[model samples]
Structure formats: structure tokens, C-alpha cells
Target chain A: MTTLYHQPLDTASRCVRLTLSEYGISTHLEVEKLWERRRAFLLLNPAASVPVLKTDDDLVLVGAGPISAYLSESREDRGAPLMPVDLAARAEVRRLMDWALVLMEHDVTGVLTHEKALKRSIPADHGGGAPDTAAMRISRDNLTWHLDYLDHLLSTRDWLAGERISLADLAFAAAVSSLDYLGEIAWAERSACKLWYARVKSRPSFTPLLEERVSGVIPPAHYDDPDF
Target chain B: MTTLYHQPLDTASRCVRLTLSEYGISTHLEVEKLWERRRAFLLLNPAASVPVLKTDDDLVLVGAGPISAYLSESREDRGAPLMPVDLAARAEVRRLMDWALVLMEHDVTGVLTHEKALKRSIPADHGGGAPDTAAMRISRDNLTWHLDYLDHLLSTRDWLAGERISLADLAFAAAVSSLDYLGEIAWAERSACKLWYARVKSRPSFTPLLEERVSGVIPPAHYDDPDF
Candidate 1:
């Protein structure tokens, strides 16, 4: 079995976890206090991000994109393929994944994480300080634009992205779930996106993530509720 | 022939250009003033980002990740394989590509582009004003950490990532080139990275990119010099 080092509330980590579970590859989940910045953890990922997977062969795969790609290739027998085999479909899937990672994750989830999580978690040496007000305001305003874009996409397709469920869907779901935990999602204004998120939140693989409890922080009451 | 909507100074756009050229896939280059936000361009990429490729079949691939993935899958022969066939290698490559897109590009190249290009090119309706000084400062300070990390990585590996040259290398090269155009790279402090970049900048596929001149902005005198 492989070992996955991650924080409970990390959207990127949870994204990798869901992809692994979908592939039926069980990993030893090691909850890492990223703020602690242990030397051992630094060796695993110099960028100091997670989730980092240590394979059975001792190969360390860092970052969500690589880990998902590795598991999708390693366990091809179980579940629907995380990435499409067709050229055009695969490009679309990759495009959506990039959007989730670069656009949504950066613009929305990043704000919440920095404002709510990092501000509380950083060590003394790590410049534990107040979040940038301007950046947070920009992030908040940008959320409306992003959610509207999501609504437009979901209106035309059943999923946030492609016709079939993909790693992209899972990635976006993880980000949304994290934001929901922080009560940052404007659910009322994004009905379609919220409904789409409800379906993703109800998946069996998502159960473990929903049940995840971050230390000193309580998730929203509706976070675990599939009907939300 | 496919049409590539691009701006020459844009690294993400250049990454797609290199991949297309390497695959011997001829494309009609349409230089887009990305800041202009023309209706047709916005229709193609809602995010208003560049490197959008319109295929011969009329399908549009948005972003560098999708465009590179599409070209890799669409072109069976020509140049070295951009992505590996082996699953582990492929995952490693993808992870590095993600690092460039999400980490380096967002933090480093994005800052430079906004400060050097976007701020100057800001159209009237977009609330054209001076650049965000605080954001630019943070971005500038963040580059040293990233450059040092890249220097450490390249100390052992010939490429920015895995063994053979992959999309990761191209993506990193593209980002670095964009910054270099703005004369932002501290080359003396990043000797190894500079050496690695020299090899990438010298490639035939990269030469055309070096020769490209943005309308208002001029690159460093040594920008086109492979030895720089």
C-alpha cells in the first residue's frame, strides 16, 4: 500500500484521495500538519504542498495532477477512466482540470484557505500574520464571476465539465467542498452550481472527505448532508 | 491548418506554439491583443486567457495544457514525444506541468505580465490605472524562492523536471522567457537554471518565439541571444 501525506482540509489532497478511492487503490492516510514543516515532510515535497504519495515502489509522487494521473494509470481495472481516451475529449478534460486548479482553486478556494486556515496555522517563523485585505476583497468579488461561469457551464452540461464524470469534476468538487466548509459559497445565488455540487457531494468516495474533521475548525452543518 | 490565437510575448501561448511546431503541425498564427477583450475572442475563451487553438475540425482547445495534450494525441509522429508513454513518467511530467501552470506561472509570470504588459495595455473600460503595487511587490519577492527551488531541481536533472524533455520543460521555459523579456530574472543567482534555459532557448522550435516582438514593449537586448 502507498502512503498519502496530507492535511484533512486541503482540497488538493482530498481531490487525490477521491481519485485514488475511485481507482480502488487504498493508501495509508497520514495527516500532516503542514504548518509544522517537519524536515521529513520537506524532503518529500520541496514546494511544501500536498498530498504527496509514496508509492509501493518508494517512488514519491507530488501534486494532485500527478497523483491522480498515476493512480488512473496504475489501477485501470476499477471505476470509469479518470481521463478520456479520445483526443478531443481528453483535451476538454485536461482543460477543465486546469481550470479547476488554476482558476477556481486560485481565485476562490485560495482566498478562503488563506483567510481562514493559513492565518491560523502558520508557525511563528512562517510569518503568521493577518491575511491581505485587498487580495481577499478581490477574491470575494471574483467569486461571483466564477460562480456565474460555473452556472453557465452547468446549464449546458450535466457535470461542471464534460459529459462524463472525470478527475476534473472531482477536483472542482473538492475545491467547492472546502469553500463550503468555510461557509464561503454563495449557495443561494448559484442554484445550478449548488445542485451540481450536491450530486458530487453524495458520491460514496466523497464520504470520507465529508467526514474529515480539521482540528480547531468546525465544518458547516450542511457539509455532510447530501441533500444540501 | 489549425489557427492559434496567441500573443508572441505570452509564454503559455508560446508553449503551445512550440508543441505545434515540434509536431510539424502548421498553424496560422493570429496575434491577439489579449487585453482588448474582443467579442469573438471572449466567445472562444471566457476566461480571456490566451493560447486558444481552433482545430481544423472546428473544435477549440483552451489553455496550454489542453492544446499541448491535444497536439500530442493528434500528432502520432514528428519530434520527440512530448509526453511519456510510461505511466509513471507521464504522471511525473504532468505534475511538473501543473507546477508550471499553477505554481510558477501564477506567482511569477502572472505578476510580470500584469505589471509589465497588462497595466500598460489596460483599456479604458477595464478601469485602466496604475498596477497594483503591493501585488507586484509580493510577486517579485516570491520569485526568488521559486527560482531557488528551480535551481535546486535543475542541479540534479538536465530538464526542469523528468529525464527527457517534456511539456514541463517547455512550460517552465515559456514562463521563464516571459519573465526574461521583462528583464526580471536574476541570472547570476540562478546559474544552473540559466544553463538549462539556454539549451531550451536554443532549440529550433524556440527561435521563432525569441524573435517575436510585442508592439509596445521591447525585450532585453540579450533576449534573443541563446547564450544569455
Candidate 2:
């Protein structure tokens, strides 16, 4: 048995969830309030971040990158690999993974999520309050730049990384899903990305994520609508 | 022949350089003025980031994470794997890799490098200007927090991740080396971390990197001293 410590709306956690479900791996989910930085969670992951995976034998994997790689290496027999077999193709997938999990999060998803959703939910003393409009404006601007880039990529390729759906697609989907939940994405202007996201949403792995929500924050009306 | 497009002061580039040398792989290095966002470089890596590795066959692998993974997978026979063979150990190594590549870069290295090093070199029109003292203060404070954490880790483990030197050590050494060159680290306050860094610096792979200098940035007197 495996247990995953995560936050429902955390993009990294969501990416892990999508990867787990895509591979048909069964695992228990435990939600962590990242801001609280619980001692127990910190012991499991010194980074005090979510999306930590602990195996039944007590092996612990922290962060989406480590956990994702662990799953690929240890559980390949359970399902197909989430990355391509070709060396160059695999590098492309990993490159986009960095773009989504690190770069995009740094500029857009993490900023918007913290400003809008996270701030609204947490206590004022614990770094929560009214969303900074200036930060939100910058985040939205970054999102627009990223969405345009994604549209350019999706217009050319069937998936974010390449020919077959891979972890890169899941990582990007997680980012886009969280933004769409916060209603931060302007999808109508990015039809190519929208079409690709719709295709991703129709996957069985994404269904449970669509149903997942953060407390005290409501998503857009069309958030879970695959056709939307 | 492998050709690496890198910026000398770039932490990611340093990691790749160290890794390639550690693996006894000979490669050609080309300097990239990252701020310029050269069109040819952009064509090689759409993200326009450095530490891109182009194989003799013309496959381009971008970013430290993807490029490192590719080298480890493809060139394992050339050297001992920088990560341990144990699955759990590999996860630990990767966790530290993320800590170095993503978290530390976001919090400390990238900010300081941009402010003190990159901005000094790039023209004013290309987003370079006076160093933001406010940002530098925050980065230095963050560096202190990270150094305390590293000191705590090095007090117990022989390396950042575990008993033996791994890619994790190299990744962190890359970050710390860059900061050390910028004279941003207060080494006297963190003895354990300093000791561990000295050990890493003694490695043959680290020597060439110590010799590498950015165009306009001069390192401190103790910057390249393995015994300092």
C-alpha cells in the first residue's frame, strides 16, 4: 500500500494524482495544509511541501519530481511509462515538466493560487489576507504569456510534449486545471490549448481531479465540465 | 561530440559541467549571453534557458533537469551513476536535486545572480539596471535560512543526500559555488556546510568550474580554494 500526502489544489500534488491515476496505481490520499507546516509532514519531507509519497515499506519520496521518477522506476510493471522510450523524446518531456512544475509555477500558477485561493482560505496571521491586486495582475499577465506559448505548442503537436500523452501533459494539465478552477485562464482566446485540455479532461485519470476542491474556495461554473 | 550551450555563472550550467566531467565525458562548451535571448539559441530551446546539451546527432536537450537525466541514462557506462543504485536512495538524490534546482534557485541563487552578476553584464535595455537592494536583502536572508538548513543536514550526513557523493552534492555545489563567487555566502557562520563544500570542491570535477569566470564578475580571494 502507498499513501500520498498532498493538497487537492496544489499543482504538483494534482500532477502526481493524475500520474498515479493514469498508471492505474491505487494509493491513499492525505490532504496537507501547506501553510501550517505540520511537524509530522516536515518529518516526512523536510522541504515541508506536499505531494510526498510513502511506500508501505516506509520509503518516502518528496516533491513531484522525485515521486514521479520513483513511480516510473519502481512501478513500471504496473502500467506503461509516463515518459517516452526514446532518449531525446524523454528529454523533451522532462524539459516541459520543468517548464510546468518550476517555471510556470514560479511565474503564474503558484502566484495566482497563493494570491486568490490560498490567501482567502488561510488565517491572516499565517500569511493570508486580501489578494494583492498587483500580484494578481502580474500573475494573470504571466498566465497569458504562458497560455499563448502553450497554444503555439498544442497547435503543432497532439500533446504538450509530443506524439503520445506523457507526464509533461499531466503536469501542464494540472497547472491549467488549477488556473481554470480559479477562473484565471482566458480559454476562449486560446482555442488550441482549450481543445487539447478538453482532450486531457476526457481521460479517466482527470475525472477524480475535476471533482476535487479546496475548502472555502469555489471554482468556476464550468470548471468540471469536460466539454467546456 | 557533445556541445553544451551554457553561461559560466549559471548554476544549472555549472551542474551540467560538473556532471559531464565527473562522468569523464569530454564535451565542447559554448557561452551563451542569456539576457540577449539569441534567436538561434531560442530555436534550440524555446524556453530560451541555458545549459542546453546538443548531441552529435543534433538532438537538443534543454535545462539542467532534463539534460542531467539524459546524460545519466545514456552515459551510465562511462562512469559510476552519480545517484545510488537503491531506489530509495535515488529518490533522496532526486529530492535534493529539486531542492537545489528549483527551490534554492527560486529563493536565493537566481535572485542574487541576476542582481549582482547578470545585471552588471547585460545592457540596461535588456532588463538590466541597478541592483535592487531590496531584492538582494531578501535573497541574502533566504541564503542564511538555506545555509542553516544545509549546515543541519551536513552535520549528520556526509553529503547533502546521503553517505556517498551523488549528483545532489554536485547540484548544490553548483549553487553554492556561484554564490560564493559573488561573495554572497557568510561561510564563517556555517562551519558544517563550509566543511561539506570544501569536500565537494576537492573533487576533480569541481576544479574546472572554479576556474570558469563570468565576463565582468570577480570572485573573492577564497572562492576557488579547496582548503579554505
Best by lDDT: 2
Q: Which regions of candidate 2 deviate over 4 angstroms?
A: A77-79, B77-79
lDDT of 2 by residue, B1-228 (tens): 999999787789999999999888899999998778899998998777889999888898898888888888786566557878777888988998888888899889989999998898789999888999999999888888788888888888988888888889999999999999999888888889888999999989999988877778899999989998
Model 1 spans with C-alpha error above 4 angstroms: A76-80, A123-137, A186-189, B76-80, B124-138, B186-190
Please compute DockQ, using alpha carbons, for every candidate against the native two-chain complex: 0.68, 0.88
Measured by TM-score, the strongest candidate is: 2
Give TM-scores of chain A for all candidates: 0.91, 0.96
Residue A14's lDDT within candidate 1 is 81
Tell me model 2's lDDT, rounded to 2 decimals. 0.88
Report the C-alpha lDDT of model 1 over A1-228, residue by residue, as the tens digit.
Answer: 799998766778888888888777788999877777889999988777888999899999998877876776666565447777777887777777777767777787767777776677776577567777788788888888877887898999987557778887898888888878877887878889988899888889889888877665787788899997
Collision pairs in model 1: none
